[model samples]
Target: MNGFNWRTLSADELEAQYNPRKSVPDFEQHFTAWVERSASARTRLPGAYDLRYGPGPLQTYDLHKPEGSATGRPLVVLIHGGYWRGLDKNTMTFTAEPFVAAGAVVVNLNYDLCPAVTLDAIVRQMQDALVHIVAKAADWGTSAARLHVIGHSAGAHLAAMMAAAPWAGDLGARPQIASLGLISGVFELEPVLHISPNQEIRLDSAMAVRNSVTRFAPKLAGPVLVAVGDDEPQAWQAQSVDFHQACRDAGTQAHLMRVANANHFNILYALADASKPLCTALLRQCGLK
Candidate 1:
């Protein structure tokens, strides 16, 4: 199934492959836990909430600083995954705990969902958020020179897009990104267009091709950790495998991790646990381990 072209698959097959919730019967349980944990994190962590990076109502983020002074610490940005249609920064706040304890400034970002805005618009919103974070890094007690991005699912797609962004040519400056942690990402957007969520995402072929990270070379001079749950559908896992290969082929340092006994939703827990391989790899990338 990994070698089969997604274009040759039937719509039903594609949906079965791409729709993660279909495979995880207790998906709601994960969401419930995340919300509860995030609330607890917000109460315990020292940070500013609802900081706006853009004019949109959803363009806000929560910044959690490390214990004591955050001066010269690495900035870790987290993007939540809701298939570009659901979820927000709030469900992701719990992910900041491990990084914050490791002495990194962590940010949980939010952006406008689909149907209300195009996927391209969401991508631009993420780029804007990165620009804002980089510009305000010093004031926040971090440095853009040691920036690390970690995203899950659709957010991972956005992080890959950021890595491939033409910052110097388009934004007039290049951000010094240290590493990218792309977990359970969809690098090939074409299959997404065939999935049920596309009704709201409204991703046409051109837009899908335009946004597919595998279609372009990454503009990064750092390592990329592309990980997926081994228990995930073969087609879904192939996305990470192929994207990691793409990054390596483009002369970027890339590593692929097949997490055992995990699924799409549960894999995020590994990211929140510093002792886990996924979290440790990211910490090492940020020079924290």
Candidate 2:
């Protein structure tokens, strides 16, 4: 399937390949688990909540701290995925628990959804949020120089964009990103234009091309992990495989991990477990393991 164009697929085919809900029949159960676990995490974890990084109403983040002093610890930012239109940062706080327990400061970021704002605006919001987080790293008990990011689905796409962003102008200096955990991300936006979610995302061809991460050479110096669930469709899995290749072609170190016995929604369960391979790799990347 190398060099295969998703554009050639029929509308129904694109929908089947890209729409995760279609593949996961019990998707709502996963969301229920995430919300419940996230709530539990919020009650048990010690850190700040609803901290605003921008003027937008949803431009807020929850910072979960490690058990002990966080001085010099790596800061891990978590971005949730809801096809860029659903899901909230609150439901993603569960992902912060294992990272924080592993001695990394974790941040769960929230941004305005599509239709209310363009995909480009959401990307910019993530960049601004990172800048704000990096600027306030000292106050958060973490260093800006040891930042790492992990995002799921659309959030993964945004995380890649952040790694590729030129941060010198925004933060006055480029922050050293230790690693990127991109799980089930769609690096190319062209397929998104065909997906049903495009009704809300409103992505034009030009905008899609402009926002596609695969089209750009990686600017990040750190290693990247492109992960996907083994149960996902061939086209869906190909997204990560192709992006991993793109990163390697750009001379950036990248690894591809095909998660076993998992699908799109449930893959995050692996990410929330410290013992799981996905979480273990991310913790190791943060220098906590």
lDDT per prediction?
0.89, 0.87
Residues 6-75 of candidate 2 have per-residue lDDT tens digits of 7789889999898898888899999999999999988889978899999998999988887765488789
Q: In candidate 1, how many Å is residue 80 off?
A: 0.5
Q: What is the TM-score of each candidate against the true structure?
A: 0.96, 0.96
Global CA lDDT computed for model 1? 0.89
Candidate 2: clashing pairs of residues? none
Across 1-289, the per-residue lDDT of candidate 1 in tens digits comes to 2375787888888988999988898999999999999999888899998999999879999888977754889999999999999999888888889889889999889999998999889988888889899999998889899999999999999999888954545654656678999999988888898889899899999999889888785857889999999999889999998888888888999999998888999999999899899888888988888
How many collisions per candidate?
Answer: 0, 0
